[model samples]
Target: MSADFAGETARLYARFRRDLPSDQAAELAAQLGLTADDLLLDLGCGTGQLTAPLLPHCAGAVAVDPEPGMLTGLRDRGLPGVVAVLGADTDLPQLGRVLPPLGALVVGNALHWTDEASALAAGAALLRPGGGLAVVTQGPPLWLGGAPWQQAVRAVLEQFLGPVTATCGSDAAALADRVGLLEAQGLTVRVSSWRADHPVDAAWVLGHLGSALPGDALTSGGLRQALEDELDRQTGPLVEQVLTTAVVARRT
Candidate 1:
């Protein structure tokens, strides 16, 4: 739910797209019963990373990113049947124009950036009855364990950038909040948490952090290399983190 971590985040994700786990996407799609008839909306869609992969699975999908650069990146990728819209999370005017009543609306890690009440209200209004909403997010496990490398990266990243914590993460509380929010709007909530063992060390942490860093932070490869080298020196590959969570709800 970070509004500030757009540019560098997009750049880093653009790089990560090469390593995307399509298996994970397929799993989530199966869990949600995503269909070609289902209209999916990717809210806070960063560079259409999720949006593009979703095209082959869903009937049609629309990706909305407020950042133009991110939208351009998504467009350059040329995802067929997926339309990219440039708009805000709370107000998706272009979505209204491009999509019919959505069968599924996805807010990937970006819902945390919106006003909770407002977003919930909008979801209630936008989705068709029986439609589903999925909130997906990822973060390092160090945040939970207070591990040295995790602590180290957070200290520096927070120092350099603002606290771009994954607020609506794979936590029980955050997932519960999504369920509660949906139920409050008279929707059926189905919540599930799945964790993936990602190889982590200082190098991996730096790559992940680099994804969250500001745009200017990545302009110089030397600076990126220096940071990565620092991370490598501090921590070895022993830090394997569990990448988790996909909270899905349905509008009844």
Candidate 2:
């Protein structure tokens, strides 16, 4: 999340990536018993995607990221009472020392990049009793869903971008391990999931892909034009089915 979302790449991420649905956030807030007296810690909070939506449920937020650009974008958001920190999951214990007790901890499409056990334990330690940690997989990787449009996009990506196999840690196996980590901390586990479809054209698809691409690869060669043209040709009126999941674990 840090290296990938730096400088203009960070802006690309902010533009293409979306916040979680507000209704879902509200339900989660209610389930977690979040109140205005509470504070949230958004771990690996790239561009504050999780923070922005969930912040309204709480009094304030502490958004932490390892990338400076990410902090910059988050700060630009001007979220009231937000304290943007330049740090990673490993820095959580140190953070725990200074911040107030946490009401909820959220990792949105990000735990895959961290040392799962350590980060979760650190986050758990920061939470007050009855508070929770919600880990969200904002849907699968852009190039790796099972829909026709998804497969078509993968084909286009493979033709130009090599094999498109990264799951951003949302694969079934990764998710199972995440659940185990949550349970290992002795928290009660429950999940909320749904499927929805969105309409998109080739440029939308291309920009989403660009957001995930590292550094100048999007600007590198003939990749951009080639992808858009080929994608438009082989693809139909595009509809992508997003399978979203939220693993909410609450401390007793």
Candidate 3:
């Protein structure tokens, strides 16, 4: 299934989607043996959240996404040493022709949207000798976890978005499965986790929900009002614990 974001949805995503912390990005870079001479490829780079921060550590980067609006957001940032490419995981081979052999290919929270095996193979093909591929998957959204206000938020989400999956990407089994797939593609895989806390207010919560749900769902279904009312009942700021797991695989 092709996942493409456009229009206001892309705008919300660019505004609300969080980037990986700098410390975590540096740690992953070190693990991948990325250096200033290396070229990084950020596959499915939504608004350059995970791609922009890592630019300083690499020679240059190619940020690829199928959505033009997301690319426009990235381009608007005017980040140097980065080129935005309009393509998906399947187009990496063609992308390689225009760009140098990559030192690392990074996929953040986007592996589920593509053919995982084919994407990995294409990534491996694009990498230079001794280059690597890294896949970073974040844990569940804060609203889905066991916080008092978060519980209320989730109830509103379920009422409109249907039953939420407990474990979408960040789980032990899923990590292991990704490792196995990478290994099968002739890569030596390693996994690591990072934990951080993010403080968010009511506005952040609502914006996050808006990014996930369609505008019609939020505006027409009375879901937006219900969420606002529930959030208003909360007393303090919400602390969201972010757990990011990285599966790094090196082509031998």
Cα-based lDDT for every prediction: 0.65, 0.82, 0.84
Model 3 alpha-carbon miss at residue 199, Å: 0.4
Candidate 1 displacement at residue 13 in angstroms = 3.0
What tens-digit string does per-residue lDDT give for candidate 2 at 177-217?
Answer: 88889899999888777666777777787777777888777
Clashes of each: 2, 0, 0
lDDT of 3 by residue, 110-212 (tens): 8888888899888988888888899997766666667788888888878877886656566678788889899998888999889888898888877776666
Tell me how far candidate 2 lies from the true structure as C-alpha RMSD in angstroms: 1.8
* TM-score of candidate 2 relative to the true fold: 0.94
For each of the candidates, the C-alpha root-mean-square deviation to the true structure, in angstroms, is 3.8, 1.8, 1.9
Q: What is the lDDT of residue 7 in candidate 3?
A: 78
Q: Weakest 10 consecutive residues, lDDT, candidate 2?
A: 1-10
What C-alpha lDDT does candidate 2 achieve relative to the native structure? Answer: 0.82
